[model samples]
Target: MATLTSTSVHTSNLFSREAIAEGTMAFRFTKPAGFEFRAGQSIDIILLNPPETDEEGNTRAFSLVSAPFDPDLMIATRMRDTAFKRVLRDAPVGMQVKLEGPSGSFVLHRKAEKAAVLLAGGIGITPFLSMVRQATNDKTQHKIYLFYSNRRPEDAPFLDVLKEVARQNPNFHLIATMTQVAQSKGEWKGETGLINEEMLAKHLPTLQGPIYYLAGPPAMVAALRRMLINAKVDADDIRTEEFSGY
Candidate 1:
């Protein structure tokens, strides 16, 4: 993991934007010269003199969905019906925003020999997406297994992109499952139901050697941590980050 000496702030303008998933929007910004960050890091985006403000404030922190190797800095979020998102969603192409960070320690372990099992729920997949993309680009030898879960495929961001990444990286494993396939209009033949001990055992040979990273709603992260502990996985092998309000 790459640690930094200090945090810096910069002004970046919105250059492009798109809807990555249902009710989710990804905004791309100009990467200030010399601005650098490791995969799995997060940043805070502050609205500059927005047309309106709310109790939620004008600043929001988001995981860097784009990999370090990518040319631009990018972040995605669920477009909640709030003043912040409203202004963000409607902001013009050249709208400028304040950025502060490259924060959070939710990065990959250094041991390449040990496998990495990433458990991502909903938008929690953002950071892991960067990690996997970087791993593929760097040709890292670490085995990566991403188990991304959502209510349905439509709600799961970057699903197709992950599939392509898996196809390109031999060491990357992708296990995408949905909790509510019936509600989805698209057909899915992949795994269904919540990820559990049985589900993990089915794909992984032995869970003891792998380091687990969990990201999701607070409740989901807590539940997965408990499941890992109950399954005899070492406490030291587990790391967690809860994603909320985004």
Candidate 2:
């Protein structure tokens, strides 16, 4: 991705705060321009550094966690890296960050409306968070299923939010899987395994009327696409976003 270089900022500061869990911080941001976005789309973040660049330059991409219908633009960072961790933990509120987009085609199009299956792993849950949130807010009529794979319950983002949305909407189903449950917090009794075709079939039996939206590491996304195709899903019905070289 090309860096956006200019002194001007495209959006205003709506939120600059952190939500903490499992020693990780998820940064949230918002702006007023009506902040229009499709449910599963993402925005490129252009962090300004007083003209200074990071070890790999000054910009990165992040998926919006807040619903498009919501009044704010939201994104969460894991705070795992030395550089990002410091910024999320210490950055003061009201600081300006450069941003562009609300871009990407991972959003659910109308043609595959009867059913939609969303697969996410770890921080990849960000985009689907927006999709499910928007679906509930708008009262979408599509049958939506979420296959969220995390190391443990504590490792996934927005557990309560996803549960709440699933509770309110009959068309929405949220299935969470933990790859390493032994190291997880107590009281964790969800599905345990990797997100592969067998696990997907167990939770989401059929993709007959559903279009699949996948986002995660490059290998995960690519592998899941192949799984869906092998399961008889149309190639065009699967959309994805892989956050590689980050």
Q: What TM-score fits each model?
A: 0.97, 0.87
Clashing residue pairs in candidate 2 are 14-30, 15-30
User: Can you write out model 1's per-residue Cα lDDT over 131-188, one digit (the tens) per residue?
Assistant: 9999999999999989999999999999999999999999999999999999999999
Cα lDDT tens digits for candidate 2, 1-246? 212221223654535665644655566676646456677666766665633445865567788887766767778767756564465456667667777776776776665356888899888888888888787877878888899988878888788788898999998999888898899766677788887777777767575557888888898898888888887888977888897853
> Candidate 1: what lDDT?
0.91
lDDT of each: 0.91, 0.74
Position 238, candidate 2: lDDT: 84
- Backbone clash pairs for candidate 1 read none
The C-alpha RMSD in Å for every predicted model, in order, reads 1.3, 4.0
